[model samples]
Target: MRIQDAGVIFGILGIVVMMVIPLPTWLLDFLLIINFSVALTILLIAMNTKEPLQFAIFPALLLITTLFRLGLNVSSTRLILGQGEAGEVIHTFGSFVVGGNAVVGFIVFLILVIIQFIVITRGAERVAEVAARFTLDAMPGKQMSIDADLNAGLITEKEARERRRKIEREADFYGAMDGASKFVKGDAIASIIIVVINIIGGFIVGMTMNNQGMGVTQVLQQYTLLSIGDGLVSQIPALLISTATGLVVTRAASDSNLSQDVLRQMLSYPKMLYVVAGMLLLLGVFTPIGILRTAPLAGLLAVGGFRIQQTKAEEAIKQQVQAEQEEQEEVRSPESVVTLTHVDPIEFEFGYALIPLADTNQGGDLLDRVIMIRRQLALELGIVIPVIRIRDNIQLRPNEYVIKLKGVEVARSELFLDHFMAMSPGIDDPRVVGIETKEPAFGLPALWISEDMRDTAEMAGYTVVDPPSVVATHLTEILKRHAYELLGRQETKQLVESIRNQYPALVEEVVPNLFSIGDIQKVLSNLLREKVSIRDLVTILETMADTAAYTKDPDMLTEYVRAALARQITHQFRPPGQPMTVITLAPNVEQTVVDNIQHSEQGSYLVLDPAISQKIYQSLNEQIQSLATAGHSPLVLTSPNIRMHFRRLLERILPDLPVLSYNELDPSVEVKSGGTVTI
Candidate 1:
């Protein structure tokens, strides 16, 4: 067993031993001294405690100390009543200490018992009972406060748990104290009874049994002194313990210990001390007598106030000097330069005027909206988006905001804090009066309008959105478009860990075995780049495990994984009960691209003739335009072999255009050939 557990067992056993077995006089004397020391230590600790909860074991300790003292009392009573000499310590306290008088020591012992039993123990017990009731009654309010802090994001789950644990401990400690306070009162009553018994019974045994005809004076004096000494020793320690219990129960929780808290509060206003000192000086001058006493006391008060002020002034100077030194050190340190070397993955910066929209206190739902956005991305994109740092930049325009990806601006926009954005349903406008502008997300012609125009704009079949909603929608699209860039090695590792919890075998076999995390991240990134949700990660990795045997290329592995996840890939574009509209490349164009394809250790590339490449590009652009005019985002349907190559060719020129292989689409998804790209 542990030392603490062993010590607990040993202490209880020792208390029992002291009660049942007679101890030598010296050992009994030593135990009595220890009992007094324990009580004194408890009182000091109670005074210095910052909070009752800080000394949670106080109630239990109180009970143990009470029992130990009772045990010591029994042992000492046995020694004194039977032997007529308890110990040197008791003799000194009873006779020599009290000028060889028994009555005075008896009175002292009775006074100590009265102070403990009637005053300290009674008060602490009442306080403990009331504290327990109040704590139990306030539990719901305290719990609600903790919940509020958690919901406000002021504390983490771990911190919340810690706070809850502390509340429970407080309740239990006070409840225990309510019961344990009885031990002290009982010990006091028992001490008085034991003293009486020792005195009455000792006199009978000493005079009648031992001397037979001994004088009453000698017998009474001998037994009475020892009894009084025993009572004095027991009662003194009990009083100290009772006082400690009262101190602990009465003290209010604070950051500082009792002494420090008392000093700080009493002297918080040094001017009060100065005022009192002035009043004392006036009294000394006007009063008829005691000027000597009053003047010196006033001088001391004034000097104390001055010293307090001087100490405060020095502390403020020291703090300011230390702060300046720290600032200078930070400027000179290489750590700041080292910090600059690292960058946040995503950062959202808004103007000062737009602060209220993001500030939690100002009713900005932006932070909360950002959390929802992250969850949405995690579910849809199957990637954990990095923490998006939001900050205010005074350097930017008052109405403008910037979203940075890897320390560079990817999207920037301006918002009119006083108005909403209204967009026409199509290219046509209903002649609603508003400021003409282009939408940031889609470049659609839009208008900024006043709150009064919102109802009219909606009635005219226009899509209207408030400023915050507009920002949220724009952010959603931005996160979706750049999901690939955010899926780094670290994010991949997190994904792997999550997957391991569910599919340990698959993750264990694939990661660091078939491929590294970087390789996995690359494949996942490639899938995301095509707006494919890698949510079917099990199938994706399984496909990768099968395909990786032949090739180690992440690009080739991604294509195979996409083919394996054809159903998911198709569901994204081809909604249920909706036929997929696609534009196909002509057979000759595909063959010509395939014929000119070059492959080496670095993988596939196209080396088509410039004229032919230009012709193909133009044809595809024309078809894409026609498809756009028809209000459809048409996919480029090509043979599986040339799909990747054709997509690679158009990546730079037509990056937004999606190219899919025939095999990668669900066979059940009806395909309508919108047009043909011919060369």
Candidate 2:
């Protein structure tokens, strides 16, 4: 052990030695000072600590202090019995306290013993017992809370582990305190027994051996005073330690220590203090013997109350001024403007009247709906959507709301909270009349009908939905459409960490070695832009890792990932038993585009003339319209090399159209040509 740790050991061994060997008067007197100092130090520490576990070493310290006091009792009793005196410390303590009266001194020592052994020690022991049981019983719940925090990403694994260790230490501390309390009770009883024996034995020794020349009454008086003084010196420190034990055991867990908590709570209401001062002033005037004492106390209370009120006001003003200065600094700082460059991935702002749709007290479930939307996307697209911030804005119309992606508005709508959205089923209309509007999700004609008309609308085969459902559905659609914009390098890094558990080898081989996180994020974002599911990430990463060494272009890498995830991609647009009817480019049109494709170090672009580009755009639009009218999603089938360029050409004008290459089509999925795009 280091010298610091051995100090405790040496002190404990010194206590054992004091019990066996006799010490001179001066040394014992100094040790007496150290003993009282240690006990007072323990009490001060207990009062200042915020909670019990903060003083985790107290139980062991309690054992040491108890043993040291017991050893002091044994050594002092020996001195009084054999030498007819213990030390000058006890002699002076007995004389000053008892004033030469043995009866009074003995009574005072008994009172201290009664207070420690019967009251403080017993209560502390019971509290420790209950605390230990409760801490042990609550361990499972505390551990589960830590685990939940870890899973929710509120805390790291290291923090959770630390919390678990603290709980165990708490349980151990309480259990040890329960046993240590007994030592205190035993020490109190031993002090009484030792003191009684010292008085009897000291009187016999003084009469027979050393003080034979003195009378029995002188011997009895001298030894009795010495015995009471020795007992008082030792038990005083014992009393301090027992009180400290009770204090630490009874303390509740808090951020503030005992003194701060007491001051904060007691002085919290200056008005109450004013009332107290007034009452004391009244008492001073009404009572005959109270003016000198109560009047000054009343004056002090009034002064303290006024000072506290002034301090509280000053604190509030200081906080307000600091907040204003911070606001000014933020507005003037260039870095503050730069900070706005990083935007919230998803933002939902509503007008004043629409706040109830997101507020829980008004039966609105929009906040919960947003969480469900994220969970649904995670299950569907295998991407963890970033947090959606919902707040109110007074700038828009009262019933209007807007959803934004990366600080840019993607979708906006207005709703009537008192009405339901009613849409026609394309069958015969029953002519239900209400406020006419267009459905925000699908843009079909709809009406904001009243509650009474809900039944009528349903009877007419009309679809009905509440205002919250409408907003939630609109948010869901917008988030799904712009998901590609949300997937950045940071999000991809988190995904890589999550995927490392199942595909450790793939992640190790690819990330930062063959391809960086940005490279992987770009490939995934490209696929998501075309409404492709990244749920089959194992295949996506494996395919990219296998092909990234030779082909560094993310567009080509995305094509390779799409080919590997062909079954998943095809299953979304086409079922297993169904033959997918797709519009394919004619050979002449495809070959013309391929022949005119220009490539340079900057990047490749289609060099087709305006005439050719316009004709191709018109023909593809006509084909897509025909396909949509036939109730089939438009998929342009082409060769792999031309797919990326062909898709890019259509992206600016017809961004919603999905273009798939032949290699991306799964072999198990049946396919058939719907029509040819000829220009």
Evaluated with TM-score, which candidate comes out highest? 2
In model 1, which range of ten residues has the least summed lDDT?
493-502
Q: lDDT tens string, model 1, 196-245? A: 98889889888767744657888888788888888888888888888888
RMSD versus native structure for model 2:
5.9
Q: Stretches of candidate 1 above 4 Å error?
A: 1-27, 38-71, 91-232, 235-317, 333-335, 340-342, 349-368, 389-398, 498-509, 534-550, 563-567, 584-596, 610-631, 636-642, 661-678
In order, the Cα lDDT scores of the candidates are 0.86, 0.87
Per-model TM-score on C-alpha atoms: 0.70, 0.75
Cα-lDDT of candidate 1: 0.86
User: Model 1 Cα displacement at 518 (Å)?
Assistant: 1.9
Give lDDT: candidate 2, residue 487.
92
